[model samples]
Target: MRGALNNLLHGVRLICAVIALLAFGMSVAAAQVRFDKQPLTIETGAGARHQLTVELAVDPQQREQGLMYRKQMPTDHGMLFDFDEARPVSMWMRNTLIPLDMLFLDDKGVVTHLHEGAVPLSEAIISSGGPVRYVLELNGGAIKTLGIKPGDRVVSRQIGSAG
Candidate 1:
């Protein structure tokens, strides 16, 4: 009887351990959030236009999980963050697996600041330089390759009147 009881207890412990591991795995998967995609265009000062499909990170939870653990992003695809109103914004590349170029835009959707070639997995703060209502993150070197610069306008329905 004693041996049977011990075996039963061991089996219960093993079941609990498996359950705990399953729960932890589920939570980790849930933490990787995905956002809705939208179409956006960048009209440069020199009469060049670039089109991209971007994921919208509009809420705090979506914004916080921006591009973390993403192994790759296509050149014509990116992420767009909307702050709801113009304010000073800052970002970092912690846990981000790929380099990016950040475009800071004001309320009018005009590019006000550009941070190009942000290092992957770095904790360095990338500031907007001034108050900005929106931020667009693209693959590294995209700014130069696309001829995007300050004064470029981002056109998207998500920006309301500025689109």
Candidate 2:
């Protein structure tokens, strides 16, 4: 009888532990997208360049609510939110902390609009005046440091394809 009671108690404890772990896992899974990093090269001008590794946000939800509530971004690190088709995009820095430079790019990766020195934590609409397929949010001043400007070419290899 004693051994049976011990076994029963152990089983209950095991079940409780499993439930706790599963709950924790689900919470973590809800917080972030499963992004695949892609290699990219940004050319600002002749002989001026930067190599980057950007997170590919290929889903609509990921692209719509990009970098919004984030507090910090590493240097040379940024998020590239992608849309299935080019459309006019408007973004706001609702809960974003670190100032950013929003680069709006067309399908061909030509920078069409640049909202530079974006003020963080503001609700004002920052829009890409024309249609855009990609929005790159980088640490403030990173574009200027790389000499990136409007009409400069931005190139990216697909997430899992060889280029």
lDDT of each: 0.92, 0.79
CA shift at 143, candidate 1, in angstroms? 0.2
Each candidate structure's count of clashing pairs: 0, 0
Please provide, for model 2 over 1-163, each residue's C-alpha lDDT reduced to its tens digit, 9 standing for 90 to 100: 9999999999999999999998677556546656677777777756677888887777876665567656677787888877767899888887577899988988888888888888998889998999988888889998778888888777887522311
The digit string of per-residue lDDT tens for model 1 on 1-163 reads: 9999999999999999999999778558747676999899999999998999999999998898888878899989999999989999999998798999999999878999999999999999999998999999999999999999899999998876543
Give candidate 1 misplaced runs (Cα > 4 Å).
1-32, 161-163
Pull out the clashing pairs in model 1.
none
Top TM-score: which candidate number? 1
Residue 95 C-alpha lDDT in model 2: 58
Q: Which candidate should be chosen as best, given lDDT against the real structure?
A: 1
Off by over 4 Å in 2: 1-30, 159-163
